[model samples]
Target: MTSVSEGRIHGGAVPLITRGPLRTTLRAGDGVRIEAVYEPCTAGAAAADGAAGAGTAIVLAHGFTGSADRPAVRRAAEVFAQRAAVVTFSFRGHGGSGGRSTVGDREVLDLAAAVAWARSLGHRRIVTAGFSMGGSVVLRHGALYTAPGVREEGGGRTEAHGEAHADAVVSVSAPARWFYRGTAPMRRLHWMVTRPTGRLVGRYGFRTRIDRRPWDPVPLSPVEAAGRIAPAPLLIVHGDRDPYFPLDHPRTLAEAAGGAAELWLEPGMGHAENAADESLLTRISDWATAR
Candidate 1:
């Protein structure tokens, strides 16, 4: 992985390697092709290795305009795989995946597909970690699919029957409320440039483009979906100095969760700035695996 500014790691250059010799692939409802790097954990292996109880599985999703090959995704994948099974895939219109971006409205379906795929592989316990837009996708998925559903072509069945399908959700730098007026100054500037730019790009048939559709024109907003995820174990991580969605976004989400959620505010951290914080990541992983 190449090192970028703000200690961010970019995994686009590196190829994904799975534990076993074989690999897995899935197709979304929209015919978007998706790939997953899987690591199998047999009952015997779990018995031999005391750390494999319950067959914990983690699905990592990248942010807007990012693919599964991003550094943050790779890092989280490696960390979670050591403890349990790990599957990371690209969102539609990004990386090797297909289809246009839906600003996370439809991407939640993609995440649900990923979770089902992991469960099909015999993962009894599942957790999803998403960064930026990916974070929003996981939250939306938790809100939308409160009950178990039939697995997609290559996906697995939902783990729970009702209100128990998703065990836990972790969102990093996710904007809880999309169209709030209390945005920070830098974010306001971004909106100023992105809104007009999105409309202009839409005129040229680039509206569904990953970058333009989500940020520029404000695609699917997550704030409206926050209330739907209450009573679920939600983790909202944000930097106190975040210039993107503003720290208030997470704070509001935590309050909305009504004591069912936890918020971790990194002092002086900026947007996606905690990519290199291994301790924080481990803490989140532990929370995901804990009963």
Candidate 2:
């Protein structure tokens, strides 16, 4: 972890070592590396005692421009750890992971690798949760990879059991459509910084000097991928007062998921606000354990 004078911490060499369960690094097909953190389900343990009977695990992903150490990510991990194993890692170039950030385009592959790592650890029941851009990755995972339970444990016949899929998914303050239609404030910010400064930061690291492309392409849109997660439980939580994404983003996702998914609208809450809310944390814990 290298610190910059401007207070921005870049995570590349500093690795997060976890001993609670198991820790590993996954190398994606695209040559990007992802760190995987896991906590096991133990009987009578402080967190998983309540969820010990479920035998489930959670694979968590952080939002855009944020790492696994973000406050929200840590809080959610602690909450979920009470009942089940919690796994989180940095997407490419964001935290201790390698490679440059491609927005959410290639990040999806990092997420897939994380999920695969979780499955290898004997997590038959898996639930994936992501924040903002990370949420978009969860939705994309549902579309690209069949949920964990889609196949039988040993060699039995594949069943259409809803439990076979990700029992539950949570997305916080995610944007349904950012590349095409973003909020006014977000558009203004993009116009102000994306042209020159954003390009410079992306090209020559955060503090270096260089010129790069104006806009990074969006390969996957939440609105387009929402419908693909059908038959699996999905939850979209967004702030009504979010300045970057329109309030309708969550609603659009809910509608796209048909009745299988639901949306929670947080009044007066900005983006990522619910992450610090005690009540919201409890709700997330309860929801994840219900499966």
Candidate 3:
């Protein structure tokens, strides 16, 4: 789980200068209630873009152990709000939402629900951008549900499934596969997600309850799913110095995506949303808007 206050603060002027995030909830694939908020783009952005970006929206998925209010998450949202509408949500179990964390598997449903809400609000061009685990979820979500009239996962997993889409996707510091513990940070994370005592610590110490169940059949790896995001451009961003995944994760995903994806291995970056640079975030915002 991500620490709540470790990074720079954002949304300081949220209620005063900018409109507060409109609150809402949507049931995920397994019917777990997911907490979510949609922040309208800063006033006059539609006019400034000559309304080209009017139908566009950006959905942000925070990292493991993170909630919508985490400073880094909020900062990214605030920065994006200056460009277009922003939707940020705590994947089930991470914040004011029901259910336990499935790490990155069931979180795909949470991202789906958020994307559905964005589309329901009439945003025709939606981009799903996530950090770390959330980044992996966005990739899977985009791959699984990019087109309508296609069969996707359903039954008990979520009430409403499929049809949600990410016209463009930006995955920041996400791993290519599961059970990665090569780095010290990831080793600690594996401990937190796999052990009972570690889960207790997660529940009390980090406010995250990682599910103990192993992935049933194992969900599609991010590298595998990257192939499906073609036609719809994919951006794989990783820090060259990322403690959790190093450079290979992004390389694998980019190779899977082939020419349909672009990769940016940041020079001095670390891991996930919290460690992402502001310039990188702005570049993501620009990418989403252009798509």
Q: What is the lDDT of residue 256 in candidate 3?
A: 86
**Each model's TM-score, in the order given?**
0.73, 0.76, 0.87
Q: What stretches of model 3 exceed 4 Å from their correct place?
A: 1-20, 43-45, 48-52, 149-162
For each candidate, what is the lDDT? 0.62, 0.63, 0.78
Rank candidates by TM-score, best first: 3, 2, 1
Among these predictions, the greatest lDDT belongs to 3
Candidate 3 at 255: error in angstroms? 0.4
Best by TM-score: 3
C-alpha lDDT (0 to 100) for residue 243 of candidate 3: 80
What tens-digit string does per-residue lDDT give for candidate 3 at 1-291?
Answer: 321101111111123213446887777656778888888887464534555456678999999999998899999998887778899999877989899998988788778778777877667778899899988888887777645554444512222433376788999999998888888989998888888988998999999877888777678778878887767778889998888897878988888887789898889888888787778888888888877
Per-residue lDDT value at 188 in model 1: 46
Two-way lDDT contest, 1 vs 2, winner: 2
Q: Per-residue lDDT for 215-236 in model 2, tens only?
A: 3333557776687676667888
How well does candidate 2 match the true structure, expressed as C-alpha RMSD?
A: 8.3
Shift of residue 90 alpha carbon in model 1, Å: 0.5
Clashing pairs in 2: 11-95, 47-82, 47-83, 48-82, 149-164
